[model samples]
Target: MCIIFLTSLLLSPARTHNLEEIISDCGTKLQTFSIVQMNYDYMFVYVNGEKMGLLEDGRLALYQRFPVGSVLYDPCELPPREVPILTDAAEYGVTACKLIPYGHYEAYIPEPTTGDLHPMTGENVCVYVTNLPPNTTAEMLGRYFEAFDMVAEADVFTAPSGECTGRGWVVFQDPSKLLMVPPVLEFFPRLFIYTSLSDKIPTRTTLQLSSVPEILVPGTDIASFAEPALNHNRSGNHRRMNGKASGNFLKISNAANAGVINASAYYFVALIRRDEVEKSVEEGVFWTNPANRRAFYATLERGPVIIIFLLQEYPVIFGYARLLPDGNADKNGFSACTVEWMKHHVFLKEQDMRNIPSVPISKMGDGVPLKPEIGESICQLAEQHPSHSTILERLGQSSPNNGRHVGRGAGVVISGNGNLGGFNSVGGGGLVHSVGDRGTLRSGIGITSLPQPLGARPATRGGHIMNNRIPQRRRPYNDNSNTYVGYGGGGGSVPPRKL
Candidate 1:
């Protein structure tokens, strides 16, 4: 009676199901690997060169056993395992294999093959593709269909408009037999289906050579369409189809004067000696550290700030008003704020100088005739400056409300009575000259000088001119003075002078 009870228990469906489950859980799916060893019934299987373990009949089963030198039948084949004494295959996959990755072994999916007429050769064979965007091009489509042996040429289309529609067509000489052509690109997330037979369009889609789709029809004919010129107009403003950024971003034309640096996009930063406000070199670079930022703000609290760069060449000068949050540059700063301030204030200032006459250097009313070429020269000077950071700092100081000026000025001279003028030039405009020493004279008489009239010769030294003192030539005119003259020509040389 005891023996009979044991037999009945082994035959129970639950016991059999449990045994199948153990066998399935012992191994993995797609066992394209080797069985290195076995621990009694549990077998150690190697797949894709990786080793793993599997079980059978509770813990008393081999995963899969194979005779040495036995060849794998399929690309997806696994190392053969010992067949269980049981005859049921369904129980192995359905019950036992459920616990394994991928459940049971499956075949490798190969690129599809197409079998149809070659439009050029009229040959009946499988079609293949080359040079594709991973899986995007039409050749890939044909390669995918070749597996079924019924696909013809795949002709893909691209709209010049770059629209999202999958408006292109794929032609098959005969697709009735070969179904399931892999999808080309799509209209949305899903693949587009080509179900029409009689409506195969003969439009010639331009081939990328690499991505070009094949059209396998009776004739090897192709057509071409002119792609529309790229519409750079992004604002939907057709009126501005060719209109460009006129102020800041436009590339300055050089077809006229070569070697001239246009200063349309440049800015200035001056480190003028605060005391010697007129001369630029006296103003050293604003060295910023945590400590300097504090000093800057402290000075700001007292009164308006002045930043300056004594530049020689750059024509257009731009300024950026950075509303720096206290400690912004000193702490973990977001560069986006810096960039935004640059785009708005500096860029707009450049535009103002370009369009509004009042915003230019002439606005100083030193009577200097502002020349467009001088602006270009200033731009060249800024570009030639030693460091980009130094230039940016100078640019920041020149921002509106900073109360800075960049042109040459009567910086401190030992002989304070030195005359200075004609610092700038514009074509066809009269020279702008600066008046000599004002306020009280060194003689302390407080006598004002005769204001020299325009186009008149410079006044003689110490000569009385119409009740005003003719100031003495305290120092001789030299190239270093603001009065240095330039003749615009190919040589582009400054005129000779002596101290």
Candidate 2:
């Protein structure tokens, strides 16, 4: 429940993040409001009176927005509880944000009322930081430094010309915390992570996902991006010379890069085949490793949406499904649990996953660990599907099919090229949702193109994948070394392609 005091707000030009989702879920049901604007802006966050670090435009999530020329913040105007720093992302849950950069005031943490002494170590520690980006707030510096130790307060310096010098001092609670910092401070440039390890992957100054997806070829509007952008970490195998990538022909798009994934939500990966997906989604269960029950179930406690890296062709990311955390092991030592498959499946190919370094593609079975950014990007890109980001279980509520989904759910007429609406599903339910000449919403499982519906037969409760006798192309089984022999067309298996 977001508490937005819109009565005193002066309507003007601005933008919002995840506002439609918020309003659709709970906002509209409680109060009547409209968008402040839909443009680029800045965002800040505070947690328990402590402000966090600044990343490039981390303003992708917001409850309510402020006008362009309004007060950025006024802590004195309201009680302390009224303000929360929640502008970072939705996955972190609670947040309080200052709207725009107008009439800028302190959205920083308050100075300690106690004496200048550590609560425990009884020592004062302050580290000077330089080469900071423009308008680097003390709160952001404090948040960044807290990675090494307990930050008490942060102070920034201003130049003689009254402009910020991009230099600041981080005050830590304990002097011992300095030991945790890198010994070679001189090597840290603009805070880039240039370690002593030779095999380390190069990184960009900004540690956030690039808002814009990279294009591979010139004058080609193909559905792809030249990933490994600043925020993205493509595979180490792909080398960059003068910003021209030699390998890893990756693809991403402006639409895919749009803020979609809930950074606060957890994401897991399941390396399963496409044929088994419908059965699992129908049965509301997915299986995982048996040895590390804690590793799989403990992480799912955060409600991670399991990404299905379908073992078809080049092992592309086929679907996105959410699993209930309460999973139990079977008699033979395998784990399984109920699942809620996202209406639209994720279809990122090998190049896409390799380019997306945050996606642990090599991880086997159902234990692919994904960072918040990767999960967020995957979720955002899933919205581009024809399903319009509908959930299977929720959509199936409108029509009953004896405890089964009704052909990828009905579609609504949404603006755009109308390229992503449901087609005549395999078992048509007489509920049509076609808009314009948009393509079919099928996952392209057996056939090359669309116009064919997926088989939606009821699934039986069991641990093993049901043998439906569906003639699926053989899945390439990769070994621990990432080297595998591809099946040949002439019946003779091709030798393992040397990596």
Candidate 3:
């Protein structure tokens, strides 16, 4: 009877306990378990018939369910573990592996046939050409790739001394064209091409503007607002069609004039300093005077504002943004509006502003249309000026090809004294001349001196002026007082002289 009772007790099932009870029993002396799989929000462990609980902080709890055929052991009972994954380079002959968070371990395995080790494919369609002739240059490579219409940029690697490194890269404007590049190009002598597609590209810094739906701001018509600014003759056909006006609202010209619209979009080109724009964008707050805000909204009727970066080289269209209606008065006594950045906006903050030039837009005439060619001109200017190259680099715009002159001789110089200075054959001359304190003087051609008094007649070549209208005033000499009279370009001032 005793043997039968012991057999029955041994065959009976073990009682299951909740996680709280298990934690009470184990106390702090619990063994950690490795997670094998997760099913129905429960973590399964490698130990047979055992499941683990998770804490609120995403950590595995000691509470576990142990069923039949399961075995639990302390840390000392486990076998020797393998070395942890290494992130950096290791010593020679040492086995090393990198642990990528949330990545599969098998992804690092090399392909048996190709021996390719990269885990992710590149996004750029750039190809690197190696083993090239020492004389191979970027221009030469660019010409060679001219056969491919999509070739956007080619850069040849050079040493610090500016010598060729026999290696270069070619980038395609369309990333899909990268697949067309062969594994090797044998067209050129001694040239071996290798796939070196980069997964990363330069971040775009230009602002993106989206048109706000007209329904958002009721009773305001963009077309009507633009009608006063449009040239009626140029937009006659656009007005005829639909009789109500349709087609692309922004485009000004069309070949047949059938789709042409005479409505010109009105925008307030606020001349915010680049530093101020950057700070506003960084802080996510844009401030303006209440009067300015009213003018901006009233003129465009809550339309999008075309923000331009007033750079020293040129005015660049940074991006487009709409001012939120919920403007509030800030501590600085200025009305503030929250700015929403468009996609792929450029960084505008904390940049060197000493080189930036401020624009006096108020002096400019109103209803001036923002020309598309202006943006193109700015882009061309950026390529020519080294100081403005950051704009192109940030925008990922390709630099102009070698040996191309970017309007170097096309600049005109006009002096404050109404003197026109012509550049030499290359248009590089400046319009500056030293002036005597008494009157205007002429130096060489296109060079004029300053300090011409108001209402004074023009001076002749011999420095004699014909002042026939006004009678000369005789003044008492003040030599003992050490006072002297000097003439400025606009007027005269009393200059103190040493006794």
Candidate 4:
């Protein structure tokens, strides 16, 4: 019996589920965190069962059933009575974990095992993945895919010349036989899953624009001063397919083709300083408080959100990012937001937000109460600035391969459209291999055979060619931003091929 007045959900959508592990002076424990979305206005919070917990790898672990219990606690009592801890397999989760003041109440939700989710199978089950991190390895990825299902085999993408490419495929085995879950990745990585099978799935390649209300010099309500009234549109046209929040979201892209982010996704302002934002970029992760989920994003729907970095003491807005919702939690359980920062640095100050709020707001997940409104203003300001990609555009940085260079040995087309775009080359086997782009790999001397171009029977290691053809590996979210897909073995690095 959980009677929850789900308020303040406009600026921040109510979390469908959550995961919380608290550590106190009494004893360390793993449990679902019970939280009430704070309402500055009238609020009612009653809980008698488990909470929807968060998955360690940025997905929600929704329980099949609701929480069940009537556990009462005595604040005067030093040691509270023990409650049954819940597992992912458990029908319900427990949110009645003990909390003590003087003791440290740290939060962490350990990553689940392969058995965490039910198994999936098919006749020729293959997964196509792209936008992998720089440090991605065959071994690490083998472990990562185990969460989805049984991996029959993990093969590195090798060019026709035998050089490994950045892109690879994981083949799932027959469900009848026992299979092992690949070990968990050493570090959590957020690579985009283009499709479950290597084959192409229908993707919507156009933007479905909608009008969001103006966040102007809007009036502030004194009665509801506890939380700023959010001003945005709810009449979005949404249709999801192939993991995309398709048909109804704002699809904005930049010239560099860096990456197209969803402008309409839930935006937020975190009370972080200039130094912290830079540190996160350097460390490649942004940490947020999970218990106070205004900051945690691991379980949020996968999409890009506008993020504004506000200084804690100063009214200064320092930086901004098109934060991808594929955020993860650290070993200690702090939520890490994956941010793709904008080049336009903000130095604006809002006088109204100079002083911190007096109301009892979440200090850890605390972004200012008027954060939603502030984010809207920042989005308008950012729209005036450049709109190129920060990370996704890096894929197209490779210099085009063209004439004048001669080679007697076999060449591997691992980058830059895989085009043997040269006519003056000494020997031409026409053996131009690439991860994507049907563009012919032209050559001079010996053009033995032209292997299949990308999007048309991609070559595999063990005589297994992939029919999982995507016309163009379009970003699952934005259909407009398409670049010739190529594999970079190590974050877009091209290696030498043998003669």
Candidate 5:
């Protein structure tokens, strides 16, 4: 019975060997060791300690022929794998280590705090940062934290004067990476970083309408500058001519054709605040209130309308836009709408806004309440379609010639009897003339004189052949020459050919 009791005691975990005794046995081979106190009576053991893969009741297991070095730990002769520090506090009871400021605002290790070795809560890991550079912005702080790990959000507090207050908070998506904060602070050495396990990270306020610059608002036309020297003519006849002119001799005008102009379309100006413009420029998004949208829809009822932007003191004409029956509203309750340009329109937030020029339009008479005119329609149409002159100019481009000849038909010919005729399909190129016949030319290869008889002689002015039967030399054909000669059959002298 006593032998059985001794055997039972030998196998019991409570009677296991001491850690110091195990280290002594290991001697110089014992690089490092750690004890994880599981309960008052039992503990886990590790050599060359690591956070994982530890052996429980290690001394009892070793006595039962458990292999040495089978429960592996990092073999490198370094500090503890979890917290790399060697101190008396670590030997005592402290498991986690933190570096705090010492007497001269320098770095020093304090007694380990009592808590879970890794007390990571499943909340957003945030760190409050102080003593930041005066010029640091929220975007800059966010970018700085992004180098360490994925940051959820960052915000830097600012003074009333728009200067940074040297205070900010950064929230990380990974709670495990929060341990990197102390090392990062130590690396910087100039800043103070406090880690927190709360999700109350600071956020900036959204841009508001009042924050927009006043310059973006449309302005009223007041009396100041003199009237323009030339005014646009409304009459279609003289529309091209800017000033009053009588004759069409010069015909110098800017008149547009009637086909393209949409006479029924109305015109209106929409005002976009500076903040909205900036947002649109940056994110391609712009929003309007229901009242303004309704007004825009009303103008569209007449026909397609021209939308002008009242930018600062000038009236810059933007492109046109049509209203949709239903549109989605953003979280801020601003409905989504599209503005059309020459090519296409894109969704405000989901697409890109086209870059267009800001051309200023002239105001009409004072207190005239800017109304639609034929000139506006003409201008809009001109923008939509190319000018008639431009079409003609494109058609007038010179074509290349590779020495190929083109002709409608055989050319007209004047006969020797003062009659006009055309080349007919004779054996030779003899022009057929009729006194009162409607003349038309027939297509032929080339012009040739009628084949003369083999022994034909030259005729004299007296209707008699010369005594010598001399063969007359035919004239060489000159395509470009305007002169034409005809031979008289009888005694009638061939009338001189006239152009």
Candidate 6:
């Protein structure tokens, strides 16, 4: 019973030899000694101050025999806690040795923090760092530096939240702390990894910043001196360049017969085509509202009726027509008002035009009331075909002035010899009444010969084009019994009597 007890006592871990003695006895095998620390299920190894790798499974079995050179860390050196053990001999296995004094295993003892100098000041800043590896605390930073020199202020922004994202800035009262920065980066969770050196260190120049400047005080009422002359010049230039006056062409006037009353000019006649002229005439008669037809005819100076078709809507059809009272010069009449194409083709959004308001017929005098003539039809047409109502309304609203648009001219009309192409006159005149597009002169006949206009230089090229919008106008000729009809307008001069 005594022998068994002695054997048991000898095998007990408490009876193990001292660390220094065990390390000395191992001799050459002691050089291979290493420490393994438990990190959850896996254990990490440290040898010669370098971390090796994780221990594989089946390497953690307890109570295994080892060879003479085998190595294992003493549990006494570690904090009182559960320590994982290796079992698989062929893998993690090592020879067992009696414990030795920690001092004898000099390589295993952590070296004092050395070679760490303030990166900026090159000062010995080692004593400024404390509680380094396992439980590094913010208070340690303050205490450690306090031993070296006076610290005006010490602020340790501990990552109280969690592990930092691997970046931090520490400002010391002495600025010497900048020297001790690790070449390797430190990590903390949930923060961005800083790469640029400027981001880590604050500069003296940046610390001296200034506030923004104040707003200036309001001055005079600059709007009072607004000049209308400038506005007029600008508006006139816009009218000349951007508006309807920009589109100009020559036209043909009456060339129907030898002695027919033809008076349209030559330059005007040479531009337009005979087919367009014919279509305009036909649509003018056919599409004229019956109610306004007679009054329109009576207002003509010498012709039966002034057939004006709104060419804006293609397939030029007669639009809502109104009579021109002999003495009515005021813009109270629709003919006196000019059409202003919007800068953008936006839908009309005015209030009065929105509702189905009543318009009196008596307001029209002898001609049909402009509103009654097209209002109901327009509304009904819009209801059925919303896509085309505005176009129709714009067409109905258009009217011809002498030869120009009511407010905008630079356009002309010809009727006497409306010959745009037919060789009736030296310049051009024909048998149709036609008005040209803006910046042009027109007459209904056929382009006979193009004559240079007054103050107008001859075009470098020939072939006078009649309509500005439809740049192309070439059609096969038919008989004059069927008058060629063309409908076009611009604000300018009047054409001859008839086509």
For all predicted structures, in order, the TM-scores are 0.17, 0.29, 0.22, 0.24, 0.20, 0.15
- Give candidate 3 misplaced runs (Cα > 4 Å): 1-264, 311-320, 329-333, 342-499
Residues 1-499 of candidate 3: C-alpha lDDT, one tens digit per residue: 4455444444557447554654454443322212222221342222111233333222322212211112122222246233232233332211233222221111122333234332211223356777666666554554344333223445566677666587776654334355555566643434355545553322211111111222112122223222212111111221111121211132221212123322223223333334455666665555544544444444343234432332222223443344444444454345455555331133232232223322122111111122222222222223233332134445343234321111211112222233332221111111221110111322433433322211223444444443433456665544444444342322244543435
Stretches of model 6 off by over 4 angstroms after superposition: 1-304, 313-315, 318-322, 331-419, 423-499
Worst 10 residues of 6 by lDDT: 204-213
Q: For model 1, where is the 10-residue window of minimal lDDT?
A: 208-217
Candidate number achieving the greatest lDDT relative to the actual structure:
2
List model 2 lDDT by residue over 18-82, tens digit each: 55654464555444433333322344443212233333443312212211111123454554233
lDDT-based ranking, best first?
A: 2, 3, 4, 5, 1, 6
Candidate 1 regions off by >4 Å?
1-269, 272-372, 381-417, 420-455, 462-499
What is the Å distance of residue 257 in model 5 from its true position?
Answer: 42
Error of 5 at 330 (Å): 46
lDDT of 4 by residue, 376-402 (tens): 445445444443323222223223343
TM-score of 4: 0.24
Worst 10 residues of 2 by lDDT: 421-430
- Give one digit per residue, the lDDT tens place, for model 6 in 320-364: 222232342242242331111111112222222334332211111
User: Per-residue lDDT for 410 in model 4?
Assistant: 21
lDDT for 269 in candidate 5 is: 40
So what's the TM-score on candidate 6?
0.15
Better of 4 and 5 by TM-score: 4
Q: Candidate 1's residue-wise lDDT over 447-494, tens digit each? A: 223222123344454455532444345544444444433343323456
How many angstroms is residue 291 displaced in model 4 relative to the true structure, after the best TM-score fit?
2.6
